[model samples]
Target: MSDKLGITPACFTKLVQDLRIHTTLTDSRFIQLEQKVGFLLQALRHSDGVRKVGHRFQHSTSTIAMYIHEVVEAIMTSKLYGIYVHQPTPDEPTSGIITRNPKLQPYFGHCIGALDGTHNVFAVCSFDLLFLHLHAGSEGSAHDQKVLAWAIEKGFQIPGPVKYYLGDAGYTMSENIMVPYRGVRYHLREWIAGARSSSRETLPSTKQELFNLRHAQLRNVVERIFGVVQRKFSILTGSAPEYNYKMQAMIPLLCAFLHNHVHINDPFNRSTGKARAARMTMEAKRARLEIIYKRTEEALQNPAVAVDEEVDDPPEDQPEGLSMEATRNEISDRMWIDYLKYKDGPRRRQQVPDHLDELLLAFDHEGLLLR
Candidate 1:
């Protein structure tokens, strides 16, 4: 059942139930809910012309078109938004993916998620690959940071002062949005090449490199979610076939809702002992959050803590370069100290073989060594 529709039979049934309760969609004498939702899913999965889909379903193109719009309206205007796309609150516990991973848990303990603008949607996604918040229907040519500002203006909330989202260089650094250090190697592939080189120098040579490495690692979640979404929904990968602007924008939001539903209810993704666990109730899933670092408001107010709550929204028209330079530098230096201690331990030997003792050097595009 999931092979063609991207959702299991059980998930499909649950979706129908939710729609029945929360939406005005009702089974008509001519077309049932099964056919309506199925047609909607097919349009999203196949991205074919309406006439082609109508032929496949043995219905008139007008019928298919009407059913698709009805389902879209039902889903978009329903109470399912709270169930599926619930925004993370300041008091909610951190994600387990961050709490369990050693590298991220230390640096990104207060990090709630990653933020990115993609496919005409600005999304904030958790490390677990669930979309926490989405602002869809932006122009494709709009700058990411500008779209983010628009999202904020439209009432997208940041979790809190201590918590932040990891973003790429395309976003500006704010108190609650940490972007990578510019003019440094920030991608995971670049770091991988540096690690695999034969020089045996595995540690980041500078604080900026270390910070960018961690930022890239944490921010890669949004990229991974986008990749998964693209693979699941063909409508996003191919050139859209002249959909109405509203329909084109709503497609991504529908995909995000289905993605979360599948993540929560797909039994094949669980182990034998955890198959029942995969069928968790929505309330239980909401309660299954992880522990977070208790960085208090008093701690933030301390002069030594370097936390700034007032630096969130910068002036709209200005060239602000690295607004949080001191904050990011402090984080990099602290992370570098800890990373150096862990990578180069006390019992490690000082001398190395001649082949391994060669200098490990990295250069920029112009061929200058990166410090």
Candidate 2:
């Protein structure tokens, strides 16, 4: 069931029930809501043309097209959209990643989430992988900063004056936008490989390096979320279909809504559970791991993947009222001071590389977003 729809039967059943209550979907004399949803999912899952999809479903292409659009409208206009793509409230507490991770809490307590642009989608996600905000339909070649500016003009709230989102070097740092130290060792693989080396040459030695390392780790959640959605929906992985540009633009948002639904319901296990994993041969597993790693590396390097790819740092000077640069310097200084005290203490351990590798491996597996 999940193979065809990318959603488990149990969750699908629940979703159908919700659609009945929250959406305007109703059973027709010929086709029912379940079948309508099936058409939508199948179309999204396989990326088949309307004619091919109609042939497979034994319906005319016109009927399939109408039903798919109906389903899209039902879901998009439904209350479920708000629930799945919810924004954080102003009074929302610190993200779990910050409050729970001792290394991050002190420095990033003011952070509301991470922001990045992936392909044609611009999004802000909390550290725990929840989609806090999303804007789709931007041109593929649009710069991250430009997309962000457009979103803000469209009334995308920054939540508060001090609260900000972590971005990569490509974005202009401001009071509400915190970016990593440019030209520093920021990618996880660099730090992980350094951890395995005896010389430890890649390990962070300065406050900026350490800050970038931590920034990369926390900011990685946005990248992983983008990867998860693109992997789950086949239509998103390829070129745009023949649909009109407006419908094409809505596809990413539709997938994001469903992705959030799956994440909330299936929290730990993937849509395809242990049975699928068990059927895989060891060689296939290794092949999949390599592919996952390759994709991760490509995502890190691609400017459109997470709005993150290394670039020369932006100028230090900011117009009045924009001072995230100064804020970052203060945080780095405090972090360095804490690190010195910790290193002098008896409990210091150099196991961060192993921990980093474990995180990388976890994402390589089938269920990368495990809690």
Candidate 3:
């Protein structure tokens, strides 16, 4: 044992048992090998781990390679269930999320999943940019859009087409999703401004800000999922082996399952974050607050506009659940108005022609009244 892998007897024993690293050999060799290889696997997963310790026994590096494959399989098959995805707005109103969460069926509150990809840098030994770009050998700076494409091909979580994904300008925007127009800011800024400007506690303009703010907070589930996956598995951020692209992707997916499990299932590990997430840009936040306050006040006072879920779809397969008729009856009881005629935005702010952008200016002398 001392000469074989240079691992302490106790460490070698633990490696085989704790990490479940499978080795091929006779019983005697297995026992002997465990003393060193076991310790190596432990170290690899931990911070203070080193491959060589006093050169006690020569550690076969291939053992560690096999170790990754086994662990990734265990994580995916045993830990994860129910792929979580962002719900898109229902076109016909009778599918997917509309059937899953009945409470959310009434309000279009669950609108988007922030779609953006991120990468981690790995040391490239023999590979070049081609290898790196595919994550076989890569740096942390690979673009998110590319990563997203890679993820989709690899069967990463993909929401259906009916719902729109919301993302920053860095992401590739499409008709199925909404990315901010260049120079336009997200709604979070508006929420922050609403909170800051109002002494009225719940300022009139602040309500929409508050709603949008909540949406942003909930959507950060994806971000936290990313952070935990990267932090827990340094192998992901470390150098990539030329042949290990598949392992790299699988490892992150497993880690995401673990993180979600620990937070949602384990009582011991709670959220390790600020109670309130800090907004990124303050200037934009203030402007949003003003806009939200103005818009919310307008919305509340408008009697014609109906604030209800646009559509709901009941599943055909059910024994005893809320009936579709029941849902519609409740919605019909509410007074909803249609007043967003102006929401049909001009294609390209420039294409809207000068007449529209100046329409607000036209109303300056004739204050536009809320119906």
**254-279: candidate 1 lDDT, tens digit per residue:** 88888887777774532222323335
User: Candidate 1, clashing residue pairs?
Assistant: none
Q: Candidate 1, after superposition: displacement of residue 71 in Å?
A: 0.6
Better of 1 and 2 by lDDT: 2
lDDT of 3 at 331: 33
Give the least accurate 10-residue stretch of model 1, judged by summed lDDT: 362-371
Per-candidate Cα lDDT values, in order, are: 0.67, 0.74, 0.35
Candidate 2 per-residue lDDT, tens place, 175-194, comes to 78888887777755555435
Error of 1 at 62 (Å): 1.0
Instruction: State the RMSD for candidate 3.
Output: 17.4
- Candidate 1 C-alpha error for residue 203, in Å: 3.8
lDDT of 2 at 187: 59
RMSD, model 2, all Cα superposed? 5.2
Whole-model lDDT, candidate 1? 0.67
Better of 1 and 3 by TM-score: 1
> TM-score ranking from best to worst?
2, 1, 3
* Model 3 bad stretches (over 4 Å): 1-65, 73-113, 120-143, 156-158, 161-164, 172-176, 180-184, 187-215, 234-246, 261-267, 270-371
User: What's each prediction's TM-score?
Assistant: 0.77, 0.83, 0.41
RMSD (Å) per prediction: 12.9, 5.2, 17.4
